[model samples]
Target: MGAMDVVLVHGIFDNGAVFRRLADALADAGHRCWVPALKPADGRTGIEDLVAKLHAYIDRHLGSDAEVALVGFRMGCIVSRYYLQMRDGVRRTKALNVATGPDPEVGDAPKPTLSTSGC
Candidate 1:
């Protein structure tokens, strides 16, 4: 496959830097990766804020490039789900929820309950 641009969004308590290894691996496989830094500071930001931030970032960086995919971890996955509900132009997007669940605002999607089984 040819090179395609990728956008990686990290979960709470972590930044885009968290995806460095994964992005590198993808790059090695001939795909361009973009792991934008979302706010990692605790209590200062929330998932809604992140969704807006990521949307703007994708618009700015990818800009009409539909050959893009997303890798969202944990809370990032929630953001991606909402984005997917809202985003209409992107051609491809993959959401990887490392340890997470549906967005609270998604309503009726069954908010996930925490357990030892993992987030």
Candidate 2:
């Protein structure tokens, strides 16, 4: 298989430097890893801005043919999930490796349909 592209998105109050070990390991294994620092912002505005930033970073670095993976913590998971929902063709991203909230109650709350291929 070709080299895989991995995108590491840090959680609130944290920065991309948090992924140094993981990024180093992935790169050692021949995969391309990215952990661009999410630009600082206020609580409310940061979410969407971070998501857009991640999306743009992925597009600029990985291109269309590369597989994209996300690693986020806490509120970062929500941001990553929201981005995954809106992004097309790029299905199956990894979540929960970092801290996150309770798993959604599928029936009680609206849930997005994720493709059953990759994670």
Candidate 3:
């Protein structure tokens, strides 16, 4: 397929830099990708804050009629879900991709619960 615009979201305790390799690959394949760093990324950011950041990024960067796809990794999935469902996202969203993985530990990580719905 031809080049497409995309946003790559990082997981908790991680920053946008983590997507460097994947971003390079996407660039090589002719896709425009952005890996924006979200605040409180060290597994302590509240879900609401992350959601707000995502919404602001889209509002400020994307055009009114722009069609873009979302690719959220791990905790990012939850952020994307909330954005699409509660922020009038379907109008501009072309596709949504979410990647989830099993938690490696529950040891000292903050235990936060989340519930979301989206198309």
Each candidate: RMSD = 6.4, 3.9, 6.1
Per-residue CA lDDT of candidate 3, range 8-73, in tens?
A: 878888888878898898888887887778888865767778888887887778765677677788
Comparing candidate 1 with candidate 3, which one achieves the higher TM-score?
3
Cα lDDT for residue 1, candidate 3: 34
Single out the weakest 10-residue window by summed lDDT for candidate 3: 110-119
Error of 2 at 82 (Å): 0.8
Structure candidate 2, residue pairs in collision: none
TM-score, structure 3 vs. true: 0.77
| Candidate 3 lDDT for residue 80 | 71
Instruction: Note the Cα lDDT for every prediction shown.
Output: 0.63, 0.63, 0.71
Candidate 2: segments with Cα more than 4 A from true spot:
89-102, 106-112, 115-119
Any residue pairs clashing in model 3, and if so which? none
Give the clashing pairs for model 1: none
lDDT per residue (tens digit) for residues 17-119 in model 1: 7788887888888888888877643426766677777878888887855556666677676666656665542344532233364446766432323211111
Note the clash tally of each candidate: 0, 0, 0
TM-score of 2: 0.72
Q: Which candidate has the highest TM-score of all?
A: 3
Where's the lowest-lDDT run of ten residues in candidate 2?
109-118
Q: CA lDDT of 84 in candidate 3? A: 70
Model 1 poorest 10 in a row by lDDT: 110-119
